[model samples]
Target: MICLYIGTNTGSCGLITAQKDPVPLKSVEVELEVRDHVATVVSTLNYENKEDKPLEAVFVLPLPGDAAVCHFSAQIGQTQIVAEVKEKQKAREEYDDALSSGQQVCLLTESDESPDIFSLCVGSLPPGESASIRLEYVTELAVQADDGLRFCLPAVLNPRYQPQGSAGAGFQVTSVPASLEPYSLSFSARVSSPRPVSKVESNCSLDPLQYLNTDQTQATVKLAAGHKFDRDVELLIYYKDAHQPTAVVEAGQASAEPGSLMGDPVVMVSLYPEFPQSVMSSTASCGEFVFLMDRSGSMGFRIKRRSLQTCIHSAKDTLLLLLKSLPMGCYFNIYSFGSRYEHIFPKSVEYSRQTMEEALKKVKKMKADLGETEILEPLKHIYSQPCILNQPRQLFVLTRGWVKNDKEVIDLVKKNSSSHRCFSFGTGENTSYIFINKISKEGGGHAQFITATDKIQPKVMQSLQFALQPSVIDISVTWDLPKEVSVTVLTPPITSILQGQRSLIYAQLTGQSSEAAEGCVTLKYSLAGHPSENQLHFSLRPAEDTGLTVHMLAARTLIRSLEMEARDNKGERDEEMKKVVEELSIQSGVSSAFTAFIAVSKSSGEAIQGPLIPPPSDFWHISAALLGQAQNYHDIHVCNFLITATESELSVKDPLLQLVSLLEASGCWLLKPALASVLGKTSKEVANLKPASASSEVWATILALIWLHGFKMDAKDEWELLAMKAASWLRAHNATCVTECVEAGNALLGCRVTKDALGL
Candidate 1:
């Protein structure tokens, strides 16, 4: 059974749950500085004490999976104190000791629950005083298919389901509705790259892009205020001459010695290795493909909308496309799960016309009706089935991507890696990225996230291409440097090397080397039976005044590698493990599970002991519930004398009214055939009306344009539906010639309906 303390105040949400704390966390602010391929974020959180006594405040939040927390500090009035990195236990003891002695202090530490989640505690704050905390971290961007580097600022942590008797799985938070969030976020990014920047894109609207230089290599953008924070803030940057592998050596901190983890020069090698044309051309496409689809309650909630198509519709369409494009000879099956699961075929079937048609028919009718997100049962069922002879097995998991038992599922996928290659596709905004990524990485497959802002088809097909392509094995990375200059590899061994994918290697360079010397790094892998290698040569000369980015990131990688080992060690806290983790954490000043950032505040007043403000969940509920119900704060009403409401008064030309009628009558976004009926026409006639353009006067033409903008941001009714009518409608009515009128209507109505938006 799962337990949650749902309260309305800043009580114990995590650590110090029953502490006599009085302060409640108030607001948070973040600033991002993007340079080249890495981003450094500084997050600030404010806590206020309104009670009559001293208090301790604790709040748990998530960091990006790849973020390396480097610096932490706290401020009250003009007194600003920086934190010292120390062993986790020692730091915790000191924090408690200081609080008990009536000293003001603050601490930040990562949770033992999950590596990406962390907790911040502000202890012993006097009445009416406010404390401000600032945390700084750096992370590298993930490159996308469009050659755009993507960055995401997280919003909420989707609660994961832990099985009975699972280890250390308490307090996993369930996701809250975005509208109920009682916080505000203001984000700004400054980007500087070597190559000329093309433009930046985001799901949330942004201020007009500003270029700092004539060459356009540096620019800045801010999230337009009043934008919703319900979803992760994602920024995609396009630059000229992208996809080229390169190396970077960052200089160390000035105060530290010249030959240490934090002070020594470090290098980051990006490898965009490409398989030989012969190898790619010789891909073994035959396989037994198994698709696991999530049919959970949260899956029913649509996170994105585009041209009347929902996340589920897009996911199903992607699956259908994959099914149709599979080679002539293959076996396939689909296992869908929620609280329960069922498979269409008792065993995998050959991918022929009859079977494919049967699967497609079933897929079209698939709904998100299962009660809860439980996928382990179906996964086990699929893994239990016997594999077919000669044909390799490929597992394609399609889901909302936010399942609870992710670690368990990931371990299972890893355990059954030999039986199949697992390709994971995440649809909808805020998909559980860590879950999808871990499964693919461990299962020797590729992962893709399809969001409302992305063009769903091409990326989905690209993942299919990877699935069809043969996997690369026996991967190794070798470094060539001077005799005295040794290297310490910070990341784990490269296991999965897919065609058109990228990888990175981080290392700390030790010993002395001439500035004229250079280093060469090469990656060797085997595709099918053929062996290949890719190499890069980088300079040894260190750049001047480089921040602690490279060192911090390298330490992060090393910490993760160590944590993985510790995890498999069954929570053993042996002396050797503790010593290594402590040394690394102290040396790099990077916070980890075994280390924390602690600061002390100098004060001259006596601390009051009043009624214990038990840190329960009650303090947090008020603001969330307040904002959630703020929806009806100022509802507009027309007096009877002013006007009377009637369905007959609704105009066909009213876009909103038309959309409502069409959606409600169909009960959902209807597909092409269903859309034909909605518009009182036969499928054949609807197909013939495809040439309607922006300027076309045809009835179908106007309907098609309206259809594209049907997925408005504030689409009144929460109901969503799917239809492909516009693509045919536009094509049949010569959309190119009708552009003028479409553009005019769009400008007048303030809506968007482009080719990409319609998936045409």
Candidate 2:
């Protein structure tokens, strides 16, 4: 049975639930269309209720942090409902009323606090009835350091801990083995660009690309059907000509009023402004560089497939490079935070040979031992300190983006913007794009991802260069259009613009123009105390059948501005603001913080009666869930299962070795780093390999127990049989080694295993 695992038992991590009797969602499919640098995605979910009673299911999931949801629709048999936007509470009330009245109702809303989170509620499905839901959203793609347009589909949403007395956080469904979920996924994408498409790359497998044109600028690709939902689906699209400015105009939606924003023509302008090389080369040598490092548990997540190194090591290495590169006279400080924070010195100190050496010593020895990812309190302390005169303060924050109160953190940064220019570096399986972007934007800085090894040093060095470069100021965009045409700007006014950075501006065309017409826009800014301008001209002809992407994207930008304003005016959620937001959301067919999409199956007259039960999102944010392993981990080379072993040769007594016999049948481990050291060497060169010795028996039994406790699965009763035999053998022969081996394994792996849990 397909199970709809939702809110029945979630404390709030955004994972799916599996109850005794649950509604089943059968299939998930996503279609993505890319134009220039923006992408619009449509997702469809199918659910069937086999139970005799009615079912109400909740699907909680994560979207791209910058996504703007524009459409929601549902179909059940002959009945189909298109959703309309309303105030969040009003939408909920309408959904509850429709559900209680025996009607099929659905509601979709973005998380009030976390922009990356969203929830879809499908209510009151009658027994044996099936429903199919579809949602569409648009987001602008981010340009990577390598000049690739990066697009990621987040299938995993980890749990967030809400602070006490704060607005309650949404619950997340826990993840399980992907194969056990029994849901299938299909994904397809189409690409169109002005520049020639070089290639498409991803960590996941994909079908061969098919080009519709000879130039290779237009193409389509699909994910291989057997793909597992184990990690963020990432796509890096490269263009032949890396840097160029372009403008695109799209036709309006036909169904809307001719003069309205939805129906009027729209234009999207992207510029990669060039700065004078002679002036940009004159970078400053004096500034205060404060480094905040993440020592949280998540930082231990390994980015390299086979290396023993984790993200923390890379972060530390980055810190070393940054510290060494700092100017001699500049002041610097290092603060590492998890639950609480600490500083390398009592206050900011000069970058001298002595201090640099001391800091390097501490940086090399730092470990990811902090309890949780708490960064707010440390930031407050940092902001409280005074900035040195004539030397501006530059904050370099490296974090895993695990904190729950993102709004609070954002507010703190905005408040401290005047004193410090913040540069953010995010690290994780999937970097926290929302938090890092907001932090950099509000603080007049730049945000970069340090997730991969290839871009780590270059991105850090580039950001450092930007930090040291004279700041660009007095930035503005001016448009010169046809005399009779009037333009309604959708994006907020330009505040901060950087050199070599690509930025997008969206606007609507209200009045008609001559058949053969063109318009121009100029970007004016002052750099290195000199005024500069860059201009572009493009035809005013509207591209046909562009859907409502640009208009909805415009609405989303407006909604975000309103939300940020509201953050500063907390407890002042007046009726006028609510009215304005609701109107915009409704007119654009988009969802906002205080707005949601609700629909009811009008053809169904009676509501189904049953207990109210909700579940999690259709997809997951797969951090490291066990799924799609073709071979038993225990039998494979230890390095292949988890950490790759190259430098350290593993010994048989290595506590992690106890894992070999333990999971030989089940999938979880191979052994340890020590094992990998001898992986390729001749057997004679390795130690402790014999038929059966007294030490071997004890060590095998103990190591097997450690594996069961550290990485055991619920099913696989046969593995449990092996475990029982190991325990019996230990009890009869060497029970004393049990506790010792467990402690040794836990110490090496940085985990906690209790005696009781180990069945001692």
Candidate 3:
């Protein structure tokens, strides 16, 4: 267990009692079972008290933001106690009473400031006693850019940087390095999908995949020998038919009363909307683009274990891609923040040669020198500016996600969501998923995470493409069911819909229907003034093997919406919403911010003596260098910076990015040495080869398009939208001699590119 100290005057001091021997936590064993997009995880944590007196252990850990924790229990010797969910205050009172009476008790509750953080307390643990804790949760895997399902098991919980005047103002964290941690983790996963399972990939070492069925739909994998719990464990699962829409209906709990959230069958529907090609071919020409970068000292850490690049450096590269991808005639600005924030321009400026170059120069010199993570202030500054007329506003936030005021940040974005859209990027293993996910959801935009093994350019460019697409409006979902049956939608209203993005909807089927009854759901929306709809039909029969996972997830969805509604209301309405939330949380046996899980062992009645003190772990900011480990960290930082600096000096060693950089704000490449060099030709040679009827700029633009198609065909996902923008600019100019330019360019670049391929 980890001990934390808060408030000022602490001075980075250790516990007066000295650190205990043989740290209470010993090892953890986890098993994961995944069916389709849903995953169920069971974890067992073993602890031993080696001290002379009674010990109370407190462990704080991070979970996925959208996970639903369903079960918690502890075993002490031969006795086992299962916890039950109750109102937070009532559970706390019972725990305190049990501890005072000398009974063994345990309490688990979600943090008020961050839903992803959970704190567990074990009281009155006898000396030399060992306890095994079992926790179970279910979560839906996130869809990645490549259509893979992403599941992350968080193992790192860095200290959150709190603002000076905020609640818990002086909170300081002392942490034991992963190498010094006294616990071991054993992990394994079992996966089954409706479609054939193609493969599974992870950043950590793993044994060979073992197939459980000849159809290749069931498989299992486990961590390799001598695995360390140093960073987050992430798995990306791929299926052959990934884009197919599907639905699962789960039967409710039998013991629960009818008409309750847990008693009714729940159905989860997954949809992937496809837009028309004509609408998708045109990119928006104008928008106010704002980029917010995190420059805190923590950003200096490696993006992932054994990676020779820091979070700040990767972010800089992504920013360069984003800046170069902006459409002509757009407005833009750049903001970087730490304890204090600074902007490249006092106000947003129109996109042009001068403005883009100016922003890139400042971004090139930026580093992670700032002391702390303070994001709230700069966000406010960005929101305060008056938006340009006829230009939509789009905000891009890049951070490592280590701020205390996450709830406040999310609320602020929710309040101002009507004015603009937000695109968020989280850049590390320990990135706060809740903060990153919530901020983007509230602002009606998309969220992406970049880990050690994940590439930053493709993901960021995908989100930029979403931003440049025309916004969808008038979204609605309609259901067609038997007359005797009805549906109660549990999920919140759909806000922003992007083409090829996944959306999940949960609903309760209350009435009875025939065994072979079929239901249909249609999603309707407008894109670029064109009406569109997608329909999915499914059988109403409950799935055979799904146990209350769907119902529990549905309950979680309603509970979250109610919690947000409570915060948005006042007086009687707020209290009323909270009451509903608490009742539903207890009824569904799911953990929430307003409720907690508590258990007491009635067999033990001996009150522990003396004041229970938890052993402290070494914790200090990485910038402080208070411990001998600083030298190792410093060495890693220097090595990463040197390698990244060399790569940057070579212009990313990526000709695609270099070609993108040379394109003008008007989406045309000028006939110059830089442009010719990207095409592997001399400036004089490119000029002499230009068609007689085509201008120099026209020839350069055609060559650029041909090169992108000829050499970078494998990376069409990253450059497709930008290429569309360039094509739109050419068509708008009514450029002549298109066939001549294509022929000359293809021959000069040694390619057979046609005019039709350039969208001319």
TM-score of each: 0.77, 0.77, 0.90
Which predicted model would earn the best lDDT?
Answer: 3
The residue-by-residue lDDT of candidate 2 on 383-455, one tens digit each, is: 8888888778999999767567888888889888878788888764555778888888788788877656545
Question: Distance (Å) between predicted and true CA of 138, model 2?
Answer: 0.7
TM-score of 2: 0.77
Count backbone clashes in candidate 2. Answer: 39
The most accurate candidate by TM-score is: 3
User: For candidate 3, lDDT tens digit of each residue in 125-186?
Assistant: 78788999999999988887777888888875556777889866555343433445678999
Query: What lDDT tens digits, residue by residue, belong to model 1 across residues 547-614?
Result: 77878888988887777677557646556776787788888888776888889876644453543222
- Compute the lDDT of residue 450 as modeled in candidate 3: 90
Q: Over 4 Å off in model 1, which ranges?
A: 1-26, 168-172, 175-183, 253-259, 305-311, 403-405, 570-575, 604-760
Comparing 1 and 2 on lDDT, the stronger one: 2
Pairs with steric clashes in candidate 3:
7-170, 174-619, 175-618, 175-619
